[model samples]
Target: MPNGGSRPIFILSEDTERERGRDAQRSNIQAAKAIGNAVSSTLGPKGMDKMLVDSMGDVVITNDGVTILDEMDVDHPAAKMIIEVAETQEDEVGDGTTTAVIMAAELLEEAEELLERGIHPTVIASGFSKAASKSEEFLEAMAEEISIDDEEMLTRVATTSMTGKRVEANVDVLADLAFRAVKQVAEESDGYSIDLDNVKVETREGGSVNDSSLIDGMLVDEDRDHPGMPRRVEDAKIALLNVAMEIKETETDSEISVTSPDALQKFKDYEEGELREMVDKVKEAGANVVLSQKDIDDIAQHFLAKKDIFAISSMSSSDIEKLARATGGTVVTSLDDISSGDLGKAGLVEERKISGEEMTFIENCENPKAVSVLIRGGTEHIVEEAERSLIDAMSVVSRSIESGKTVAGGGASEIELAMKVADFSDSVSGKEALAVRAFADAIESIPRILAENAGMDPIDTIVELRSKHEGNGKTWGIDAYSGEVTDMLDGGIIEPLPIKTQAVSSASEAAVMVLRIDDVIAAKGEEGGEGPPAGGPGGAPGGMPGGMSGGM
Candidate 1:
């Protein structure tokens, strides 16, 4: 109002939808809360799975937080922000995606209460930031330094991740395999660095989940391309190629016209010679097994098979790299570069029928730095879920090894941190203390939901947990399977400290980011399309908010 009251000046386009003040904050908080509530039930070992069917009716059945959020066809911008929290947690720690999303939702929920009580969003954000920072210090103090030699504890970390994954009867075996694969590929340079990508996973739907096995080397999906080739190569010498074995075609568009039949016969003979030369090059390199990124012509395959060379074509570039790491071989780009020195070695390169499909297994490389895990289950959905479970298990194990720190799981860490944070909040003065205390309560929601998901009474569980930790029971927490409060450490429930810290930090950041927003503007998309594609940050996130107070 420049003078008293004039026409409301509109800086945005006429069709934009805008929300301001409490209304905007409320909308964002509600959307975030909805997302959290959606995944809260899938929290603990006894937690149930969600079966999400997309618009195309593609079904995904699992409790993996990031996967669920990823598969969700959400349109709300605020809800999408919550998904970012889960994505960050997953990308950083590989586990704790659900915990992170749930924490952010609870934080916003607590902030909503503060907002109603007239606390500024900035004050709440500041308090939450302080709480998150202090919690990190507390968590570090609580963590016990672990080493790779702590195999039993590492196994426990993996087992804790897979507990509620609808996994097979042999969880112990699966956990062992997960950590084993991590150990195999675990490398140390400046510090402990584990390339999880080096740990290859293949899922099969024939055998039971217990039948899953970890291989010492890489697994190629395609078997030897020709039947005449040797099915097994002992002391195998592998030649990895990125070039095609067929005759090279000209780059330009041209046509060949032969006036005589002899000319065409000469052309065919030259092509045959070129293909034979390609096979001869591989044979000259003394490569018993051939894996290529491009196709091998039928004539070349026939010649290679006649030479008793095991040949597989059309492999992904990733497979080629994995084979290089597994077999200690070099990838030769050109046929001329195919030499004996360039070949990789494996104790056995064999093709075996797995679930009615023949696949190649390159195993027993000397001190291999890469490996594969063949995950098996009786059904397709089970196999998919097991793959997800194993990913979580392997991720926790690797994070544990790299950080060399461990914490008691089963809500033990969350309860103790909440108490500490609550005490810290009381030391603070002013309205900010309320937001700090709110953060403490929000973190406690983790343990509360864990209990709830386990079919136990959340109030009783929290009460018992608080009582246990009141003295010096930092490791005391609920056991999801037994519905009993006990020492999580002694019960073989543990997690990497990084996972917990990352979840808390990311959740707080997301909550603060969402809370600080008091205005939302969704402008029309550029070129006058549907909405907000070319629009600035003020533009709609995906599409305009429904029935906002504006032209659109």
Candidate 2:
């Protein structure tokens, strides 16, 4: 065992695909359970908060499941897939992040049991699909009788996403605001297209301003320091990008040498003249406003001010379109690109001097274009949470409003879908029938997620109860850790339950799919955390960096 002769240090053997498959399945199940449990309580308006703390002891209080998963410091690749499901929902609906995550976890849990009992993952997956379709039909049938105008619809929608919690109050306010904002923007247009950002949902320490007045056009930004930024325009034109282009950088190894005093003086004169000439050329081109990448120099600023020309600096290229729309003006990066038609006729801003600053209202135009939202917040923390919620709310509401309708809230939509799928699966032959159970398992994930979030043991409870109920021939049911199959309708816990089910189903399905992947794709610069220490795996890191980074 020393140097010359090598005895077996440890009879090492490469794992066969079969062996690795087992491990992979286990890992997938564990990861799925983790995700399901994590977002369970985030369901319903009354849903509880998940106090996520990082190594630094920073804590986050939130009932939003997708947010919790996205912010959680998860290591497993499979778990990351669950995160992706939440991300997908956030991207698609701006809401349903929680529902997606919880459903995923539940799917995985059920899959794990089914797999252990000799059912193929593919079978479970198929079954789950069937169940999903069947569930959808059920929900639709249930919902058809429910009037959209009924206040219960609002409560049901709210409660479905969030349990009956204090947060429902906040969600209600935001939902109302979202609805109003969408309506206002749509009313201004013939088509469904609306400038979502224009609906400013500001939470001010003061109060809301509710004055309703019509402008011939729109105002993009609330304020522009210059007096000539124009409030309205006719026949507006625009462009928008996500970059600034004011600051100029010198090329590498480029040099300008002036040895003598006369030469230096000539160089200075030439530079100043060129700068002045450039400004003159832009003005000659009929440009009234020049939105720059950086703040203007004193000379340029003075020149524009004197010319009664407005030059807004430090503007992102994308916002230029909004400015152009709001002012019925043209937006271009290079001043040379501007045209006569591009420059729409401008209007004046109504100004009122308040304190030392001026409050200006720019209005009146035909088909004006602009984009902006004035976000107001109170203290730092309150503002932070409000902003996060608002961004998500905006994303969800915008997409739904644009699409002309909202889905059943709290995941009832998905559950009903799953049930329909189950019926369809029964009509199919062979492997297709497997989809029925897979889909049902998928829909079941919602309730499992709720149980997990409520600090109930999802696996032990759901599994035991399912097993017992199965023996008793109750094929359609929900299992509780308390070993009960209580009627959901009688319990007054129906809508939100579906939300949790959806989350779990989505999470589990996605997780299982990811785990089945045997190949590891290498991505450059991916931050793979080190393995768990000798002690144990730790809690997730702090919530995602402040600001609207992760949401749609």
Candidate 3:
């Protein structure tokens, strides 16, 4: 080159940092899109499963978008951002896991174009935050009308929550059960706990609800016998009969030899009377039955039977303690050691039923409200899936009830808010006008997401197209899936659906945030492990592209 000639080292440089930064942003956007597409089809009750196999041949099949994303072990930075969004949604709402994942993916897609045009990500993020706040405000204003006062509306809430599955067995039935359980607990005592843990909903085809009964104490499965032994106990009392006849043993398995003949005779006489007195003492202590771990001699057994006392041999120590707790009694080891105070009392078990659902309540328990939900299924896998669904349903439904209110389904409120924003788009100030327009566009996606998940073509559907309608029998805009459609009003389409409003809010937040970042630092050390730790503005000594700080 110094000699004014072309050389082998042909170097035409632009700015490597700028170039790489763009690449990183693109990579992030692409990764999010992949995750979104992966979960998009898997929304709703009829959603399908994603079968993922790890490098080690481990396989997982689940329709849960969060589960799929979590198990995939994503490495892309942008993909990780989407995963973080899913985690945030899961951490907050027990439902909406899939919706969050897919919506985040859609946001990145929308941001990629703006990023290509040299607009800074920070500006986009700010717009997104503003829009999100406005959208939430609009939703709140619309939420005042949807109330939980009516029982019919309560069932509707349950039905909406259970939308897309085979829950027809009884959404109303389950809701009523939950309501009654809450009422019962509230009526029973002050400061009572109303929880799914205490109120069980078991589905037994043949089990009658009329068979429900309350037991007057606690019933924990405390079996001390061998595992295969009988599980049920009936009409039993404290039995403290000891099998050992003699009071003293001189040696192991050896008959004792007394030095004095009178001493030996006295020993024999004392042993005979002591055994009889031990039995009588226990009977006086109110023990109607006796259980002996050691072998009972014939004399003691005959004497006990004659006294109308029933004795069972070979009782386990654990079962004895269990019996004691159940009957509010204490375990007696020796009959001679028994006293009237040692015996506790137990009452009869009662049964009642309602609506063909059987419930068991333990009466006289230390805590009367303590109940367990025993979910049953025809098969193991079916039961497991049902259990998972029930747990999620219980959590969401309980929170909704306790909160006493929620917005309409299918994102109706959010769509209404977006419409309001669009209606006033012409009156907004300077940069915010553009931001508001973007916000409206973002809000409109809510319905598309819902329709797409619901097995309808959102781009070609009436509801999705109607969201962009400008009134006066005219609708013109690019559909969410990049399709062009007009005449939405003539198609007789109405307002945005509930799921749509939710999806728009979520997607807008995510998409706007992606375009806000201008710099990405990915440091990998030569040691093949994590790079050195660093944070904030000082960390970028070499300078970053677009003069953006690595603080984010």
Candidate 4:
């Protein structure tokens, strides 16, 4: 309220923070471009790794774009949107996360130039939308259908995904494992479906990465529960029990008073009797091997060992589920429900010590629906990185089988798409045509970055690529290994079609969203009164015009 008798006058506080017009647009575009530049160097086979140290001083070293962006503590809204572009690309295609983010940044950078030429944001956004849809159409037309049974091509796709990672020495071996694993778990219905969960990857640090091998059945991280039990069971009839061997308590808390010595004796006798009955039920079901999700009582263990049965207790629920799928068994919830049909069959169930740790291997099922891959590396970090690489490989193979198509990699697909998009720009007219042309130029950044990362002159490499592509050599791409422009298809550089298609759609959408923002309003700080000055949360360093002043 103003002075006493005057009518209440409404007014905005002086501390209110807001930025409109060019100021807001510049701040957002700068933040997004900064994030893109941070990851542009890590784009290809010759790309270098990023070593990120968090607040806890923990270090993560990887060239994987998604990992780098995910680990960064980005604060700016526009920067966060760029991270979403990477995440979406990863979630949909499992590879090309970096490419998606880089593409979006370049698109926004180009849009900024159009903005300076007085083109409206809506005009630029609409042009980008058209370019994105056209690129997808070009990608589908350019893609080559491949049979899921084509193991050689699948291996190439997997290897291409892992080429820039830390596990370069064993990429072939790992790629083979990944291809086999995905194929082993793939199912064909109306279309192909792959449950990657069925393909488990377990890592151990001791032997070299070449030691990694795929198992036809599931692997349990546990060993035999009792030493007296058989170390190995042949022609194993396995029972999966969720019920505990020990006596279960009442649903509600109740007291069982034992005032005399005879009462205690009776209690012990009752528990022993119940355990014996449980063991008898399992044996009657002809289950020579037992895997229990709950603990096994000492008395129960002795009885099972005396019967010469192989038994392990406290198995994880996930392991138990995998065992059921791999061995064609049903998880019985109660001992009394044990039946022959509930037992799983395995050629052999054995306990082996690998790297000084005991693990149970259930092998040689008739037709396993689930499998495992044991990844062995020389060190812990290597094993971890190998697992990441294998996951990427597995995901790419799965996507390829699902989509049933692939495209030449090594920047070949991008260059082809760029040329097609550039040709498309000719059909459109006015300011929108310039925006479409900028989009075509943005797509070329992939090949440009690939050449730059390989230490070659980007200009000469792109020129050669453009010439080759323009001459109808659609598969010609920069060979990062030798820095020579050659046939990516003949060189065995390939990737799943979904990766490129997803990158185009996701990156363009994100770029248009950022371009559409023309105003920003920040609430005042609790202690500082005003939140941030007009341009953004902070002033640009050295007073550089249109610099990213916000902490992103």
Candidate 5:
């Protein structure tokens, strides 16, 4: 439009925003570091908790890295990516999310120094890739094999996970429960494998944490279906049914017309006869207890009560399936298919009132593959926190058993990894060696944070750890309770090998991905007004306004 000509000339929009080269990298690194600092204080056993208040005024008090990140209202794209690192760590390993995020931020910090030295991003990324692979080798070599039957070791692993949580008061009891629950569900075909779903945790408030116990069978938050049903049945023969005890309706809409009183009476008799037949079939199955996933009709209830069957209806399908596993019962879909062979045996099926609500317990299964851990606490919040602690404990124990190896916790493993990686870095030549050494330095953040959180001088503690690791004391880690360097394994602080390995691997990958980005083009906001016209010049298709577009 310079000469008022008809020919169109494309021009960049005024609203677009962009950052190139070092500016973009600095911005992203700053965002990631900020997020890391936000969660740094909540790193170790002595770490403090963060109280996050949402827009709705709901408050969450936790030191869990993933939970805190999930609750925060992060908006920066770089910060969100860091949060994803924590999330992936949590989803894959269930713990050490804080370790992962902190390490990634530190790596970026080190990489920023390299970038300032005129080192190319690709060289830094390639060095990180090599360091990460070397770290994995160090981890596997340093790990010690653990057997699932080693209850003491497993309990130590669980205790280490719950050390800083709200359930510290009952950590011993919860740790024992978590260990037992995981072992109960662990399969040992090729190697130890645990399906965490098979270990169910049910929480109930108003009781002390010490009151929590592990059940050999499933616990259902349900009561008897009818008032006339037995409240307790000993040596119970359980029949699990997924189909409804009530009569089925037609698939499509239909009309039932009663022309006269005689026709209505005949219809009622036919319905009553069908209900009676269904009850008789259940009775013939020799089941003293009935747990149905669907509702039971009043007529069927009356018939069941007449036979003194302990019937509980309206159970969830998941609960029914779990019950089938716990009681060794087949879930029958139809009454006609129920037989003595389909019944599951339980020593007792009883309705007990807990917290003023009746809950049915199916206990004393011969050898239940699926088990329940009933968590009890004086308050709802305590119970919920205990549940979270138990979940972490369970996950760690299962992870340990599956991997069949564990390493010292409390930052011991990280120090050893750092030392080994540093030695490995010495063999490499070129500027990438400097990057690899930077990667080694980045891993020191874990032990450093652990010391700082425990009120010890981080530099002194790190120096002491390095000296111990350089000598014969490989498992020496900071003892948070005393702020002294001690053997983590001897201190009963241990973690599965996968947690540390995954944290380092994930953090390195995230750091490399972030470092490779040299340009950031952020789009302009489209709020408060209409966007650019569809297919318009300088606009994306579908009327979407064009964002800043540039390259470094």
Candidate 6:
């Protein structure tokens, strides 16, 4: 239709949508910024919480960035990219999600300014990448190396992660519990590495946060399979099972013709004998407690109770793994070859009822490699938040131990890195230098937002930070409690080194990826439903981007 009055041909379907050039950039940037701002106020210790309500009337109240993003239905592709940043940060270090998303948003914000000045998207992306690399270098140089033995430092790092959550009132207790649980499961190898899976959390309501305690072994949320079984077993020799205790049924259908009454009696006795033999094998293996990954038959339960064995059915695989580690036992898949050595040992196995729920406790294990932290609270919401807070705390603590390094928290590390990155940008010559400088400005927004959320003057905070960090005091950060600039290290505000570096690395990468786009091509579904493919309006190829020199 362009050269003259000619018939137009379509490369895509009639419902396809496309936004090209500057309009596409604006649309993507606006969407990313909107999501960034949505989670911005949940940044630091003074940040506010969000109450998310679902269609079924289920509500989740949390300030956790990943949780909030996961709950929201983000339709735009650009916004979903921001969510990925938060998810990656959470998965990598379990904290600093808000910082990562906010940085990505601010980078786009700065790139918009450059876009208005006629700067190319590629140039902005290049500058941001360079800036991000410089920031990581600066942070690595600024970090302090510590070992797993630095308990107080680890405690401070744990407390920092749970600062603004609902369980802050009992943070000290929870922090200590998290650290100890991680420490108990920490094993020394080529170097000190902790498998976070070893530290399990069990949440139950109707108790104060102070009631939270660390169990020496794994806690399973199931009672004994039958009431007649012993409530507690001392010096428990447990058999971890992957197979069921039920008698097997033939896969193919068969007809059993009982020609006489004695023949039917013989069949019943044979079935009872098979059930007795299964329980006899467990007793022969010296297993006083039985935990199975599959179901236990009613007849099998009677035999186990008659033998005074405490057993649980339908145990999850994760719990079974933890139990093996805790009890120093191996899981037996088949009953045909289980020996006394195949059993696991625990000093005591008991079934206790707490808050109307029965839970089996396999405690008093010797040299246990796995541990549990029971999280208790006054209500269900508080318990949920407390569990989330504990997870964040435990994750940070484990990260600190594994990395053997940490940084001063409370925005000190961010402002210092920003200062260093901005100065590094001076040596680069070109429009890209502006983007690099923009990266510095983008991350500095962290401290500004921190001050803002804490009810302080952001401008004053940034100015003072720049002054103090000019030639000295890199560890100085805004003290929300006192509303003044103070040394974070001296104030015991610390964070794992990986969290900060991962945040900057991921945020900048996501920003660069978002910046490199000049066109958005979308296609509608067969039913013409709205989704990421519906980001832009349906249109023709005639709306091609304007920056190209050749015809399409």
Model number with the top TM-score: 6
> 141-185, model 6: which lDDT tens digit per residue?
999998888889999999999998888999999999989998899
**Model 6 regions more than 4 Å off:** 1-5, 525-552
* Shift of residue 12 alpha carbon in model 3, Å: 24
Taken over the whole model, the C-alpha lDDT of each candidate is 0.89, 0.49, 0.50, 0.89, 0.87, 0.88
lDDT of 5 at 167: 81
Model 4 misplaced regions, further than 4 Å: 1-16, 524-536, 539-552
Q: After superposition, how far is residue 486 of candidate 1 from its true place, in Å?
A: 0.5
Residue range 1-552, candidate 3, lDDT tens digits: 344565555253322122246655665566667767767776654456677788998666556556677786544455566777777665544456677676666556656665666556665566566666666666555442222344455445554444453433544444444333433333223322235444444443333222222333433222221222222234434453334432545666777578998998997777767767766776777765554555555666666666655554554554445445445565665555777676644332222242343222223433334333444445443344444455444444444454444554443443456676665557765555555666666555655665565566766654644544435222332232223343322321212123333444556666666555546654442343233222211122212222223211
Give the alpha carbon lDDT tens digit for every residue of 194-266 in model 5.
8888887888888799999999999989888888988999999999998898878999999999999999999
Among residues 3 or more apart in sequence or in different chains, the pairs in candidate 5 whose N, CA or C atoms overlap within 3 Å are: none
Q: What TM-score, over all chains together, does every model reach?
A: 0.92, 0.63, 0.56, 0.93, 0.93, 0.94
Compared with the true structure, model 3 gives a TM-score of 0.56
Evaluated at residue 255, the lDDT of candidate 4 is 86
Clashes of 5: 0
Which digits, one per residue and each the tens of the lDDT, describe model 2 over residues 428-467?
7775476455656566566455455445676764665455
Candidate 6 global TM-score? 0.94
Candidate 2 Cα errors over 4 Å, as ranges: 1-23, 53-59, 129-173, 180-289, 333-340, 344-370, 405-407, 410-435, 441-552
Model 3, global lDDT: 0.50
**What's the distance in Å from true for residue 98, model 2?**
1.1
Candidate 2 structure lDDT: 0.49
Candidate 1: give the clashing pairs. 525-532
